[model samples]
Target: MDVSKVRKDFHILEKRVRGKPIIYFDSACMALKPKQVIDAVNSYYNDFTACHGRSVHYFSAQTTEKYIEAHRKVERFIGAKENEVVFTKNCTEAINLVANGLKWEKGDRVITTKMEHNSNLIPWMKLAKERGVVHDYVEVDNEGKLDIEDLNAKLETKTKLVSLVYTSNVTGATLNASEVAKICHDAGAMLLLDGAQAVPHMKVDVKKTGVDFLAFSGHKMLGPSGTGALYGRLDLLKGMNQFIVGGETVKNTMLSSWEAEDSPAKFEAGLQDYAGMLGFGAAADYLMRLGMEEVHSYEKKLARKLYDGLKAIPQVTNIYGPSNPEERSALASFTLKGMNPQEVALILDESANIFVRSGMHCCHLYHQDVIHEMHGTIRPSLYIYNTDEELDKFFDALRNIAALA
Candidate 1:
């Protein structure tokens, strides 16, 4: 792949910030949109801006077609069936849809790991507390990788669901979903993955993993914000209750009697973000054209380079996952000794024109167990758009910051 040509597709990379070129390394939080995705969204608004699934008029039909086509794109991207994918506001909402929609009874157990983001953690935690269900956490080693032995031990007879983050947003630790799913199935528990950080940077085969459900956001995958999906097995979706019920989710209604729609449409309860959904389709197509294999390889090279460089700096404190780059995503989280992560991030932004994320990254419980300071870790997440040259600049800035310390 032509690196320069790929960079040109993102118009944001062409601009300068504070008279210096912007070096964005926060793609894990949200990826910069490409021109193709932008154009797709723009065209939707310009041509058809009507209510979907409501009317039989031309614009409404076009809107409905585009919205349903986006569902197909999401299904293809994640190796799920069209009826299995349910659109949500973001990954948080998608996770919540599963966590809350499921039939939870007293003595039921839900297992997750300490490495999970709050999106995956809090929803289950709330369910455990409110529904009198038991929640167990499979603790990770200091290296930020899950202890499979501990996980297996926790899979007791009562284990009802096993939620996991396929890739950590903080440490970039990638989990083996296939193995995890097998273990969960052996215990007769359903496996639901938080793919918010994994889907964009890695290749995901939900069928091969044998997971029963999965959720991911499109903003992190180069699409517009406020768009995400939840993939649930057809039978499971059929069994679960619809959390949100309104206009588009009902099949037929009377004053006191109403029938629910089919699997996905029943779950999607409101007038949807049609433009954003279509743009998500374009984003999926964009990544598919670039090839997920190439994206993974390119990102691994950059991750290892960043890891090695950070290790050489004495004042920089690195918190990484597995030792192998092939086992992780391009993102990394670290902190400068004696410096607040937010303070360091501010200095880098003001002095070096580099953008990075700082603080708990909404994974406070995980960081509280790992780092001394409970607030969070400074996260520098890389992506296909970021080049090695920008990473070098980041290293130079860190080195200079170390001198100040």
Candidate 2:
């Protein structure tokens, strides 16, 4: 799918790391921004730098229109209603908003999985102690697959919410979020999905998934950092309490109390990142032009290549996940015998000019379950900008490292 054209969109690829052309394979951590997103941010600063949803001046109105337009674009991208989308600082903040916004009492249960990033896990854990709620975990199999039976078995009357990661950043295994969402709904629980890794690599329809809530970051999807979104069902958002309150999110204020603004406005307090939101809109437009289906196909092809290449290396061992190409993202997690992951990563960066992430990747609990280490796995996540020639070079480097070991 237009690999050369896609590669040209990201200027970062043109630079050299360690005196060699950069070989970035860390999209799961953060993706490189494209020219369109950059220009969008630049245009905002150059032409319009005014407060949004506050003033009636020309630039202010234009700024407000751009901000609202960005939200509309993001809503369409995930197939959700515009009011359902709430802008946040990042995915971490978005998840916390859900965890904090809910009104809970003693004996209320929140179900989650061990495969979640800390942003998805700790919020519930803290809620358990602070609000007298119960936190339940659905265990994953040794092979990194969700134990759907265990998930069903954990359902109970008091369960309030079910939050899960759409795809594991450590194992590269994708989950059937639609099925999980149905299970949660049947149990009278709202399902909230962490879509950090899934949104960029696959198509997601919040309505089709039956999820009540979903969250993702812009930087993971070719946009700038510090921009994220939380999508909640309109009914739920209407009932949920506000997380932040200020000038933009208040309808009226008395000396002792205040009435909060409407759904999305009540959540987004203070001065928001107008330019970043515009850039995120541009990023969404960019991906939509490439087509999510083509993006998914391209990454799966690369993932298959990576899986096959790693499986054939005698000295390398990969963690359990999707063995077939169909069940994974464009990411690989592995360790080399007789070589520490950190050391291997450093050598790759310093000597071979390769960039890869070699740590827990913010999923320490999942790492403990599989690798039994706190530091976690070495992750090499690919994106559309990567090429088959890059994969071949990666294979050669692995072979050389294997010989040294």
Q: What shift in Å separates residue 367 of candidate 2 from its native position after superposition?
A: 1.6
Which stretch of 10 consecutive residues in model 2 shows the poorest summed lDDT? 369-378
Clashing residue pairs found in predicted model 1: none
lDDT of each: 0.88, 0.87
Alpha carbon lDDT of residue 248, candidate 2? 87
> How well is each residue in 21-97 modelled by candidate 1, as lDDT tens digits?
89998888889999999998997899989999899999999999888898898889888876889988899999999
TM-score: model 1 vs. ground truth: 0.98
lDDT of prediction 1: 0.88
Error of 2 at 385 (Å): 0.4
- Compose the digit string of candidate 2's lDDT tens values, residues 1-405: 899998898999999865689899988888999999999999889998999988899899999999999999899999998789999988999999999898888999998888889999999999988888999999887657788999899989899998888888877787898899888889888889899989988889998888899999999999888989999999999888888778788999999999998879999999999999999999999998999999999988998888888888888876557776678678878888777788888877887888899987887877786568655566788999998899888888878877888
Report residue 23 deviation for candidate 2 (angstroms): 0.7
